[model samples]
Target: MASEGGFFSAVWETIKTIFWALIIAGVFRTVFYQPFWIPSGSMKDTLLIGDFLFVNKMAYGYSYASCPSIRLQRFGIDVDAQDICFFLDGDNTRLFGDEPERGDVVVFRHPSTGQDYIKRLVGLPGETVQMIDGVLHINGEPVQLEDGGQFVETYERQGPEGRPPRCENGAVGPGADCIKSRQIETLPGGSSHSILNIGDYRGADDTGVFNVPEGHYFMMGDNRDNSLDSRFPASAGGVGYVPFENLIGRADRIMFSSAGRSMLFFWTWRSDRYFKAIE
Candidate 1:
C-alpha cells in the first residue's frame, strides 16, 4: 500500500509540472515570441519551404483586434524580461517596433485571406515602382542584382519547334526558350536586392506609375513572375495593396530547416539552416 501511494504521488507531481510549463509557454508565445512554420514556397530563396522560424511578436504592438484573447493566470510570475517583449517595454506604442526600412524582410497577415505571408519590402510608401522589360525600377531608377546562384543554368524549356531547348532564367516559360534574366535591384531609398524575370510578359511590366498612397505598401515576391502579390488586382482574390493595420512582425531568423520529411522525432536534423539569420 505504501509503495503504490508513492508511485501515484510522483506521477501526480510530474503531471502538475507539465501543465504549468505548457501554460507558461503559451502565455509568452502569445504576447512575445511565437514560432511559425513556413507553409509554402512563395518566399522561396529567402525563406525556404520547410523552414521553422521565430517571429518577433512584440516587434509590432498587439491589439485585442488581431489575436484571440485568453484568461491570464492568477498570481502569475511577473517575469520582467525585456528580451521577451521588446516593443511593450518602450514608451513608443507605435504599432511597429522600428519603422520598416526598404529591403527589410517582413511577415504580415494577407489582406485578402488573413493568412500569414513573408516577403521582402520592395517599394515604400509615396514611391513610384514599375517593372520594365524584366528590370525593377524604383522612381524610374533601375535596381541592381547580386550573384544568386547557378540554378538557372540547369533550367530548360521548349523551343519554337517544340523540342527540348536550353533555357535562360527569364525565358518566360516552357514556350520561350531563352534564359530568363533578372537584375539586382536597388530601392530608391538606397537598399539593394534582387528581382527575377521569368520572360513571361504581362501588362504589369509597365504598370504602377501611380504614387503609392499614404499608409499603403507595395510588395512583390522575389520569384517575380510566380508570385500573386500587390501587382494583381483585388478582383482576382490576390494581394493588391497591403494596409498598415494588417502588418505583423518581421521574420528575424530561421530556427530550423528540413528538406525531406518533417518528423520531429527523427534524430537526424538539418543543422546547416538552424539559427540562420534571414537576409
Candidate 2:
C-alpha cells in the first residue's frame, strides 16, 4: 500500500510539472518573439505583404496589458525572452527601453487607428522634413540617392502572387497594365538601404515642408511613390507624425521570408532568410 501511494504521488508530480512547463512556454511566446505578418504594400520593395517577421519585445521592454485603459506591465520581470511587437500605442501604456535614432527602421502604431506601421525614420524631433522632387531633405541637408543596387525583377503578377490585393497606393491587379518594372534605388544614410520608385513624378514628391513637432518623428516608406506616409494628410489614412511614445522598437533583423503564398509551417521553408540581419 505504501509503495502504491508513493507511485501515485510521483505520477501526480510529473503531470503537474508538465502542465506548468507548457504554461510557462506559452507565456514566453506571447510576451517575447510574437510573429507578425505583413498585410500591405505600403512598405513594399522592403517588406512584402507575405513577409513574416519576429518583433523583439526585450529589444524595447515589457508590454503591459491595457487596464482601465490598458496599463503597461510593471517593470522588473525576468528577461529570459522577448516579445515580437508590431507597434507601440501612445497611451503611456508601454515604455521603450531605448530611444529611436535617425535612419533606424522602426515599427510603430499608426497615429490614426492604432494599426501597426513600419517606416524609416527620416526627420527627428524639432527638425524640418520635406520632399523635393522625390528627394527627402532633413533639417537642411538633402537625403541624396546614390545608385549601387541591381534591378529587382519580379515575375509574380502583383495580385495573383497570392499576396493580399489592395488598391491602397495604386495596385491594379495580376497581369495588370499598371504593373511596371522599376529599379530599387539605394539611398545612403547613417545606414544605407534600398527604395523603390516606380517611374517618376510621385505625387507626394513635390510637397510642402513638415516641421516635425517636438517629441514627434517624421517617417517615410522605402517605397517612396507608393507609401502613404507623412507626406499624405491624416484624413487620407496616412501616418502623419508619430510621437516618441508610439515607437515599439527598432527592427533588428529578418527572422524569416517566404514567397507570398507559402505559409510559415511548410517543410520547404526559405531557411536562408532565417537569422539574416535587417538593414
Candidate 3:
C-alpha cells in the first residue's frame, strides 16, 4: 500500500512541475517576446523565407494582439489572441502605448483575416504615400534611391511552398542565376534600406497618393514588386493601413535562418545569419 502511494505522489509532482513550467513560458511569451517564422518572400533580402525571429512585444507596449495565438493543427489546438484577451479588443488603444517609427520592420495582425504580417512602416499617420514609377514618394516628394547593383539567387523552387522567384532578366531556366535590380532606398529622416525591383512600370509601380488615416500606419515590403502591401486595398486581398492597436511587436534580429524546406535539417542552416541584427 505504501509503494502504491509513493508512485502516485511522484506522478503528482511531475504533473505540478510541468504545469508550472508551462505557466512560466506563457508569461515570458506574453510579456516579452513571441517567436515568428518567415513563411513568405515578401520581405526578402531583409527577412528571408525560413528565417526565425523573436518579436519584441514590449517595444510598442501591450494590446490584445500581444496575446499569444496558438494554432497547432496536429494537436487540434486553435486559440486566437482574441480568445485569450477578448476584453482588450474593440478599443484601438494600448497600455503604455508608444508610436512606431518610420522605417521600422513591424509585425501586426491582419485587419481582415486576423493573421500576422510583417512589413516596414513607411507612412505615419496623416502622411501621403505613393509609388510613382516604382519609386517611393512621401508627401508628394520622391525619396532618394541609389543604384546598389543586383540581387541574385538560384532559379529553383524555394522554401516549403516550392515557389520560384521572379527575375528581372525574366524566364531563366532552372539552375541559372535569377537576378533583380537592387537599390539603396533612403527614406525621410535618414533611414536607408535595400529595395528590389524586378521590372519597370509593373503593377503597383504607379499608384494614387494614399493619405494615411489618423491612428493608422502604411507598410510596404523590401521586395517591392512581389509584395501585396498598402499599395492594394484590404478589400482587394491586400494589407491596407493597419491600425495602431493591431501592432504585435517589432522584429529586431534573426535568431535563426534555414535555406531549405525544413528547419530540422541542420545542414540547411545559414550560419552567417544566426544572431544577425535586422536592418
Candidate 4:
C-alpha cells in the first residue's frame, strides 16, 4: 500500500510540472517571439519560400485585434474568439509603441484578408508613395537607383525539360535560363537592398500616387515585376495601404531554410541561409 501511494504521488507531481511548463511556454510565445515560415517568394532573395524565421512582436506596441476574417489559425487557436473577448471590447491596449522604418522587412496581418504577409516597409505613415516605370518614388521625388548587375538562381525542383519552374525574370544563355538584373535602390534613410528588375512593364510598375493615410503604411515586395504589392489596389488583388495596428512584427533573421524537396533529407537543406541576418 505504501509503495502504491508513492507511485501516485510521483505521477501527480509530474502532471503538475507539465501543466506549469505549458503555461509558461504559452505566455512566452504570446509575448516575446513567434515562429513563422515563408510560404511564398514575395520577399525573394532576402527571404525565400522555404525560409523559417522568428518575428519580433514587441518591436511595435501591440494593438487590439480587429480583423474579422481570421477564423481558423494554423495552430488551431481561435483567434476570432480571442480577439472578441480579449482585445475588441474598447480596451485598446498597447505598449512600447514604435513605427517601422523605411527598409525594415515586416510580417503583418493583411487588413482585408486577415492572412499574414511578409514585405519590406517602403512608405511610412504620411508619405506619398508611387512607382514610376518600375522605379520607386516617395513624396514625388524619385528614389535613387543604381544597377547592381545580374542575379542568376537555379531551381532545385526544376523539371527535366526546363518546363514548370521557368524563370520569370528572364532567361540567361542558351544553356542556363534563370537570370535577372539585381538593382540597388536607396530608400529615404539611405537603406538599400537588392531588387530584381525583369525589364518588363507590369500592371503595378506604374501606379497613381498614394497619399498614405494617417496611421498606415505602404509595403512592397523585393521582386519588382513578380510581386503584387501596394502599387496595385486591394480590389485588384494587391495589399492596399496597411494600417499600423495590423503590423505583427519584424522579420530579423532566417532560422532555417529548405528547398521543399524533403525536410528529412539533410542534403536538401539550404545551409548558407541558415541563421543569416535579414538586411
Candidate 5:
C-alpha cells in the first residue's frame, strides 16, 4: 500500500512540474518573445522559407495582437488572439506603444483575416507610398537602389509547401538554376536591405500612390514582384494598410533554418543561417 501511494505521488509531482513549465513558457511567449516560422518566400533573400526566429514582443509594446493564436485543425483546436483577448480589441491602442520605424521587419496580424503576416515596414503613418516602374517611392521621392548582381537558387520545390520559386529567368527544369535580379534598396533614413526583382512588368511594380492612414502602416515584402502586400487591397486577397494595434513584434534574427519540408530532417538544416541576424 505504501509503494502504491509513492507511485501516485511521483506521478502527481511530474504532472505538477509539467504544468508549471507550460505556464512559464506561455508567459514568456506572451510577454517577451514569440516564435515565428517563415512559411512563404515573400521576404525571399531577406528571409527565406523555413527560417525560424523569435520576434521581440517588447519592441512595439503589448497589444491584443501580441496574444498567441493556436490553430490545429487535426486536433480541432482553434484559438485566435481575439478569442483570448476579445475585450482588448476595437481599442486600436497599444500599451506602452512605440512607433515602428521604416525598414524594420515586423510580424503583425492581418486586420481582416486575423492571420499572422511578416513584412518589412516601408511606410509610416501618413506617408505616401508608391511603386513606380519597379522602384519604390516614398512621398514621391524614389528610394535609392543599386545593382546587387543576381540571386540564384535551385529550380525545384522548396520548404514544406513544395512551391517552386518564380524566376526572372523564366521556367527551368528541376535542379537547374533559378535566378532573379537583386538590388540593394536604401530607405529614406539610410536603412538598406536586399530586394529581389523577378520582372519589371509585374502589376505591383507600378501602383497608385497609397496614403498611409494616421495609425496604419504600409508594408511590403522584399521580393517586390512576388509579394501581395499593401499594393493589393484586403478585399483582393492582400493585406491592406495594417493598423498599429495589429502589430505583434519585430523579428531581429533567425535562430534556425531548414531547406527541407521537415525540420526533423537534419540533413536539410542550414548551418549558415543559424543565429543569423535579420537585416
Candidate 6:
C-alpha cells in the first residue's frame, strides 16, 4: 500500500507541474509573443513555406483577438467568428501600441474570410497606390526600382507547369526553360524587398490607381504577379485594402524553416534562416 501511494503521489506532482507550465506559457503567449506557422508561399522568398516565426504581440498593443482567444477554442474556450469579425476585421480594432508604419510586415485577420494573413504594408492610410507595368506607383509617383539580380531556382516539389519551383510565370523550374527575371522593389518609406515577375502578365502588374481610404492600408506579397494582394479587388479573390483595426502585429524574424519534409529529416532544415531578421 505504501509503494502504491508513492507512485500516485509522483504522478500527481508531475501533473501539477505540467499544468502550471502550461498556464505560464499561455500567459506569455497571450501577453508577449505569438507563434505562427507559414503554410503557404504567398510571402515567398522573404518567408518560405514551412517557416515558423513569432509575431510580437506587444508590438502593436493588445486586442481581444490576442487576449488568448485566437487559439482559445483549442483549450475548450470557444471564440465566436462573429465577434472576431466585428472587433478585428475592420475599423473596429483598438490598440494602445504604435500606429502601423509603411514597410512593416503585418499579420492580420482577413476581413471577409476571417482567416489570418501575413503581408507587407505597401500603402499607408490615405495614400494613392497603383502599379504601372510592374512598377509600384505611390501617389502618382513611381518608387525607386533596382535590379535585384536573377538566379535559377531548383524546386523540391512539382509546381505549376510541371516545374519543381513554380514561379509567377506559371511553373518552370530546375530544368531548361525556367523563368529568371526578378527585381528589388524599394517602398516609398525607404524599405527594400525583392520581387519576382514570372513572364506571365497577371493584371496585378498593371493596375489602376487605388485611393487608400482613411483608416485602411494596402498590402502585397513579394511574389509579385503570383500574389492575390490589394492589387486585386476583394471580389476577385484577393485581400483588398486592409483596415487598421485588422492589423495584428509585425513579423519580426524567422525562428526557423523546413522544406515540408518530416521534422525527423533534420537535413531538410534550412538552418541559415534561423533567427533571420525580417527586412
Question: How many angstroms is residue 229 displaced in model 6 relative to the true structure, after the best TM-score fit?
Answer: 1.4
What would the TM-score be for candidate 4 when compared with the true structure? Answer: 0.83
- Pick by TM-score: 1 or 5, better one: 5
How many Å off is the CA of 188 in candidate 6?
A: 1.5
Roughly what TM-score does model 1 have, to 2 decimal places?
Answer: 0.68
RMSD of each: 8.9, 7.3, 1.2, 4.2, 1.1, 3.8
- Which ranges of candidate 1 are over 4 A from the true structure? 1-19, 64-97, 146-149, 152-183, 201-203, 261-271
Give per-model TM-scores: 0.68, 0.69, 0.97, 0.83, 0.97, 0.83
Top lDDT prediction, candidate number: 5
Clashing pairs in 4: none
- What is the per-residue lDDT of model 5 for residues 155-208, given as tens digits with 9 covering 90 to 100? 988888999999998889999999999999999999999999988645788889
Model 4, 1-279: lDDT tens per residue? 999999999999999999999878755655677777776666766776678788887787566432222345677855552354354324324456687788999877666666778899999978999888888899999988898877766643421222222365544444455776788888989998988876664557787889998888899988787677787767877888887777778889898887654344556678898799998
Alpha-carbon runs more than 4 Å astray in model 6: 1-12, 68-91, 158-164, 168-178, 262-264
For model 2, how does the per-residue alpha-carbon lDDT over 163-261 read when each residue is reduced to its tens digit?
A: 433232365545443332334333334566777665454568778889998878898987776688888766787889887666655677776766545
Please give the lDDT score at residue 185 for candidate 3. 91
lDDT values of the candidates? Answer: 0.62, 0.62, 0.92, 0.74, 0.93, 0.74
**lDDT, candidate 3, 72-155, per-residue tens:** 999999999999999999888899999999999999999988999999999999999998888999999999999999999899
List candidate 4 segments past 4 Å from native.
1-11, 65-78, 81-93, 156-176, 199-201, 261-265
Query: What's the ranking of the predictions by lDDT, best on top?
Result: 5, 3, 6, 4, 2, 1
Q: What is the Å distance of residue 271 in model 2 from its true position?
A: 5.3
Give the alpha carbon lDDT tens digit for every residue of 92-199 in model 6.
556685778788889886767757789889898888998888888999999888887773555556322222555544555355454556688888768998777665
- Cand. 5 Cα-lDDT: 0.93
